[model samples]
Target: MKTYNLAFKYRIYPNETQANIINVTFGCTRLVYNRFLAQRKELYETDKKSVTYNTQAKELPLLKLELPFLKEVDSIALQQSLKNLETAYKNFFQKRTAFPKFKSKRSTRKSYNTVSTSNNIRVEGNFLKLPKLGLVKIKLHRAIPQNYVIKSATISQEPNGAYYVSLLTEFQRDIKEVPSDNNIVGLDFAMSELFVSSDNQRADYPRFFRKLEAKLVKAQRELSRKVKFSQNWYKVKLKVAKIHNLIKNSRKDFLHKLSHELVTKYNAIILEDLNMKAMSGVLNFGKSVSDNGWGMFTTMLQYKSMLLGKQVIKIDKWFPSSKTCSSCGNIKDSLSLGERVYNCECGHTMDRDLNASINIREVGRSLLAY
Candidate 1:
């Protein structure tokens, strides 16, 4: 049995008092993280020294003595914030991400992470027990496995004032690999339809953001006309946030359902490993690329396939899947983006994405033979 971690998120309804406490915790965690990050930067610049999580964590007690309000919130959340800073620094040094930036007070999303200790975090019917805030009402939409053990919980408040808790749990399971060359399919990324499958099926993605763009623009126009920080302005801001949330939720739901369908139908799924960031920024296809949620779909396919003992294969990004003929394997000198239909001198003509998907599947099959 191998151990795995999974996160289950649930909507939480806290009393006014508990809500205040949660908000306070978020502020305290952010404050601690920013404080330590600034200190680390100053120390490294002045004395050529670095601060570790342990060094900063040991000072929390002294900080509480100086700022006393820090003692009112969960202590573990503060430590977790420091740990997050450490992680950020590690990622920066490893060239995996840019340097960490200071947390802004006006940020829309507010969150803090807390660990479970001594049964401090648990679910009881319709309530969840959390650190410092006890027995907040939770909407348990799905049942958790009996063997899963709660590890940590992340509490977050969305822009629309909805509170959610994502519980990280650990469990063990045995997964055996299922190898099959017959049940395989390839997918080519599509800007408008999401993807084209080897079997000539399109995802037929409904561009959620595009559909709601006009509504969002009108809402923002009204928000702009209102006085900033006024009651009316706040109300309009909430309306705008709700619209954005609707788009995000709709897109996520579609991707989840489509990924589930693909995983269920294929044993081995192949795709081209396209750099979505480059495609969005360098290629100037930001809006269309972001609306499709291709990156999220690929991630879902990978994890779901692994759990089901299936496969997800990605060919090289530089492969000339589009410029090469799928029938005769003739490589063309060049193929323009406007050419939606692929044509070769060998008398093969097909839709461009379908041809690319076929090439991806053949390449994946060859790789599997090795």
Candidate 2:
């Protein structure tokens, strides 16, 4: 099977012309998204929502027809914006969810007008070729395959004033026989540590946020001293963003490595399908929650399991595994986060995470066997 994959962290340097193209497409995409979101909000608030795609297509030409300049940017982005509105509405109404909120004007709310599929783009020895952008002078630190059907390429600017192109690709792999029944492990997630496994192995959080907390606060204080929208203020803003980005990158590296090891070493892995969105509401990690990388870890583990042909069993969130005693088949009445050790009145004693992990693995194995 040809599966889509992404090659990230590729350095890019777009000349003046390319930069103009990127900016134009990005502005066009943002405008369309904001307009579509406004339309949806008005539809939900009032009753008249006759804005169908066919009508949009017919009406959209009139929008750019007089100006004609807006059409210079990629038309594909406008279509996708309309498609997103349709799909989002369908999902919300079918599931009976609240009307989708309008897109925020905050910078983070914007999506880039990147290529639909980055795999269609390619990097030759000295030059990178994009479908629309053509061959610009590309620097290759490593050799990438010259021939592959390009899908889409998203070129983005980072807070550190560096540019990057994320090319999504597809490739055929020679399937290897999955080594079944190799090793089964269960893992427990926590706040202080990244995870503790059933085999008594533990991976602690790198604590990047904790380490930089003092420095980040100092930077914010300095930033506050600057006048709003001034050059110094913008510089301070970049400083804050850079530090946050550092924390994010560190956490991602740790999570990716940990997930890779777990998936490779164990044939069957058991973990809770943690409701991170819900958990975030209850936990006070400040901005660190976004940088904690728990959600990213689980997402990586899930996909790695599928890609490697391993079994990843998501135990129910309310399965009582944490409060259950693995030694004597006893379930405790209550358990708190402070309890590092589990002591059962039935003469069962074990570490809290260890016991929980054992229960998870046992329950998962039983489920798989059945």
Candidate 3:
């Protein structure tokens, strides 16, 4: 049996008192993170010394004494904030991410993490007990396994003013790898459709953002007309946020369903290792790319495939999948994006995406043979 961690998110409805406490916790966590970050920077620049989580954790009590408001919220959340700052620094040093920035109060998202200890965090009937905020009502749409241990919970408030808690749970399960057979498929990323599969299947993803673009624009225009920071302004702002939330939820729902179908149907899924960020910026395809949610779809496929003992293979991004003729294996000098149909001198013709998917499948098959 191998240990695995999974996060199950549920909508939570907290009483007014609990909601106020949660908001306080969010602010306190943000404050602690920013304060420690500034201190670390100043200390490093003046004394050529680095600060670690332990050093910051040690000073947390002193900070609470100075600003007693911090003591009113969950202590674990504060420690987690420090740990997050440490991780940010580590990631920056490793060249995995940019340097951490101070948290801004103006940011629409607010969240904090708390670890579970002594059964402090748990689900009872329709209520979830969180640290310092006991028994907030939860949706409980799905039941967690009895054996799975709750490790931590991340409480977040969205721009739409909805509360959610993501419970991180650890469990042990045996994953028997399925033998690779002929049940393999390749996918070529599509801007309009989500993907084109090797078997000529199209995801036909409904462009959620594009469809809702006009409504979002109208809402934003109305919001801009409102007096800034007034009650009406805030109400209009919530309306705008709700529209964005709708788009996001719709896109995620479609991607999840499609990924589930793909994972269940295929033993091995192949794709191109695409640089989506570069693609978005370089070609000025930001709107189209973002609407498709290709990156999110691949992430879902990866974890779902892993859990099911299936496999996802990514070929090199620079591979000439689009340029090469699938029928004769002839490589072309260049291919233009305008040409939706692929043509070769050898009298072979095929749809560009379909041809690419075929090449991707062949490459993946060859890789598996080794």
Candidate 4:
């Protein structure tokens, strides 16, 4: 049996009362998380003792007695908050992330988690039954798979004040077999184009941010003119946040569609392992580099490929892909970014990005052969 993890996200509509309850839950969860974080920090500083999940969880009942508002929210949500903090600590010890920090009430992104136990969570018709908030209207965009077991749900409020829930589920399914005689392609990421494929296909960059820069600048300026913490300021802040959200959603949609198309057509995909951090540090190109989201695109490709039983290869960052002649295998002595066309001494010439993609394909084939 092959076990897999799946997440189903959906938009939710909460009434005024439910929304208020959600807000209170968010605040209470934040308070509990910060309190425990402070406790752990003090413990570590004073006696070099590390605080674990069990130790903190044991104190929750006592905490609720003192802070009665915490008891009003779902107990599971409070426990889950502590669990999140513990997970953050684990990540820090493993060097996967920095140390955990206290959550802020003023943060636009607020969320809490709750596990589904004994049918506490369910979807009926067009509503989702959560622990504290009962039967909220939900836009069930897609049906949940029959085999999947709902484990937990993360309720979050976005910057634009839209509410969403991501249901984490688990199931077992057989992995798709990778066909032996399958089409392979290489991808070259560029600023002008999102990607160029070895088969001469080009996906033009959608420049979503550039298109909205003018509107964003105007909105931000208007926001700056408002008095801090005033009603006008709050309204403008939401407007600016909505515009930013639009840009982010558009970019994410485009990337997901492109990655899905590639994974669908090719049995194997190859790409250069670019140092995105170093690329972003370059003076003039930093904004473009960050806006392209190369890292996020690659990550999506990798996970999607894994789910579909497709192969993805990453070549060394130092590989002279643009400098090497795809036809003759001769490495050029000098190549500049300004040279959009690759010219090799062996009388071979082609579009630079296309040529590099072909070289990446060749490298991937060689690696697979071994």
**Per-residue lDDT of model 4, residues 235-337, tens digit only:** 9999999999998889888888988998888888899998887877874777687667788899889889878888888988889988899999999888989
Ranking by TM-score: 3, 1, 4, 2
Q: Identify the runs in model 1 with alpha carbons over 4 angstroms from their true place.
A: none
lDDT for 173 in candidate 2 is 52
| Model with the higher TM-score, candidate 2 or 3 | 3
Error of 2 at 173 (Å): 5.1
lDDT (C-alpha) at residue 230 in model 2:
94
The better-scoring model by TM-score among 1 and 2 is 1
- Considering lDDT, which of the candidate structures 3 and 4 is the better prediction for this target? 3
Q: Each model's C-alpha lDDT?
A: 0.94, 0.73, 0.94, 0.90
Q: Clashes in model 4: which pairs?
A: none
lDDT of 3 by residue, 1-370 (tens): 9999999999999999999999999999999999999999999899999977897899999999999999899999999999999999999999999999999987999999999999999999999988898999999999999999999999999999999999999999998887768889999999999899999999999999999999999999999999999999999999999999999999999999999999999999999999999999999999999999999999999999989988898899999999999999999998999999999999998999999999999898877632
Candidate 1 C-alpha lDDT tens digits along 1-370: 8998889999999999999999999889999999999999999999999889998999989999999999999999999999999999999999999999999878999999999999899999999999999999999998889999999999999999999999999989897888755899999999999999999999999999999999999999999999999999999999999999999999999998999999999999999999998989987999999999999999999999988888899999999999989999999999989999999999999999999999999898877632
Q: Ten-residue segment with the worst summed lDDT in candidate 3? A: 361-370
TM-score of each: 0.97, 0.86, 0.98, 0.96
C-alpha RMSD by candidate, in order: 1.2, 3.3, 1.1, 1.6
Provide the global lDDT of candidate 3 against the true structure: 0.94
Least accurate 10 contiguous residues by lDDT in model 4: 361-370
Q: Please state the error at residue 236 of candidate 4 in Å.
A: 0.8
Worst 10 residues of 1 by lDDT: 361-370
